[model samples]
Target: MEVIRNLVQSLVIIIILAMFLEMLLPAGQMRAYVKMVMGLLVIIAVIQAVGSMARWSFEEIPALVAGTGDGGGQLPEILEAGKRISARQQELGIEQYRQGLAQQVTALVKLNQGLPLLDVEVSVESDSGSPDFGQVKEIILTVSDNPKQTSPAPGGTEPVEEVSPVTVQIGSSETPEREEAVPPQAAAGIVDVLTNFYNIQPEQVIIIYR
Candidate 1:
């Protein structure tokens, strides 16, 4: 649609320029009417372009209103909540909390990019000697490209193949007695926060579990 409009605008300009050229040359009465119509169209095109550039057209008002209206009063509340959380973290000298929040944000970004949960991780800890710094535990999730499948054998029985599924694991002191299972959503959230902390896009991340 945009391409079509641009083409139309270019054609209008060309027609107007052609009309002006014809007027400058020796022309008949037919040229006079053509020049007048072209001049009017040029004026209209210029007005449309100016209006579009300024976003002053009435048709766009609804979209503008909708954009601003969706959040309504909720935007302030959300911002305030974020600010309060930030202030509290600074006040308490809790760096781990900030890290956790960052991990959560990364997870959200990963989810938006449609990355698997196994590609994400989260680390949280309590402050030690330093009032601000904390010992952190990381939960790493990684997705495996291979998966096990069973296929029919040429003779009789089925043949089995080993395949890999996405896996999530925790890292740090106090490892799970056994491999702990992580919820898909939790894994995704970890990815979200990590992405935000590193200021990188979630889709590009590949985490290796130790």
Candidate 2:
């Protein structure tokens, strides 16, 4: 706006000067040349004003208003990237939650395995539609029948081996002692542990193998 105002004032001054110059010049070819030069100056001034306007409107204005790239601005692209990252983070969080729950149950069960302990594996399930992974909906367990002795590892507990019950030979007879499955009381104890500590329900627990 200021540039336009200055340009307009310059044009007005040029016109006034041309008019004054015309009267001061004596009637001759020199006056004709002077008039022609003044006309060219007027044209140049108008062109300069129009060029500035065009540069501002076509280049600066568009660059400022609309972004140059795919989504009209960098902000939308950044927001989309953030949304993807947030979704991935949520998936990782849910997986970690499930893993943690399974580990805790396994540790607790191993520590409490009764006299002639059974080898056990624990699995936890969460609601598929629930975003809050702490809400455990179901629990599954597998337990071995026979208790195989294991030598302790240097810095960790040794893995238990799955073995069938052995038979002992007596004089004139054979005695086969079959390993028993996990007891009902132990199963109930597992349900109680989850229910009391983790707020789970007894009906939600399933012992697939015992």
Candidate 3:
């Protein structure tokens, strides 16, 4: 009667503890593995209790529960694997978010029509512990008056256009001519648009002319 009562109490305590741990566990593939381990533990406890009632010795049960056996060593490895999987998922998610943000920024810049935006690059905070995690860090806009043609060729190589060098006078009294794909006003407007829409600082948005 004493053994039976103790077995029931042990089972109840283990079940309640498992439920509590499940609630604290993060959602991912790791959760399934953890649940399986917990279930195995419950089974082991029951078997151990039954063995005691039958006067049978199961020496390995305690070792397994204490995580001292070869099989028990796998638990740490499983946890490490879960952490890696979670980190990889986070990286993929951040990349997708960056791509989407770049597209949106490109579209917004195109609304001006004056600034020839070739491409947009977005940087984001990747540290999960940081307060600004997942937030945009920087944005770079590539502008060009003559955008590079990306048409495929039979040789898998695109033809390069040669640019003539400008002659500079050694002691010119007048200011040298400077070429810009996007004008000052248009660039400022783009910076303003991006800053306002993204709620980021103007300095965080950069424009590069090619």
Clashes of each: 18, 0, 0
Model 2, span 65-84: residue lDDT tens: 34343333455655666666
Looking at model 3, which ten-residue stretch has the lowest summed lDDT? 145-154
Candidate 1 C-alpha error for residue 3, in Å = 8.2
Each model's TM-score, in the order given?
0.24, 0.48, 0.52
Better of 1 and 2 by TM-score: 2
- When sorted by lDDT, best at the front, the candidate numbers are 3, 2, 1
lDDT of 3 by residue, 56-77 (tens): 2244443444444644435566
Q: Model 2 clash pairs?
A: none
- Tens-place lDDT per residue, model 1, 1-210, is 564476578667766776666667546767668777667867776666656645533444333333443334354555665666666776566555655554664456455543333334444445454653443345444643222222233375754444445456657465435333344575466557655665545653445422
lDDT of each: 0.52, 0.63, 0.76
Predicted candidate 2, C-alpha RMSD = 16.4
Highest lDDT: which candidate? 3
- Where model 3 places Cα greater than 4 Å from the true spot, the runs are 1-73, 146-180
Q: RMSD in Å for candidate 3, one decimal? A: 16.9
Give the distance in Å from residue 158's predicted Cα in candidate 3 to where it truly belongs: 7.3
Which of the two candidates, 1 or 2, achieves a greater lDDT against the reference? 2
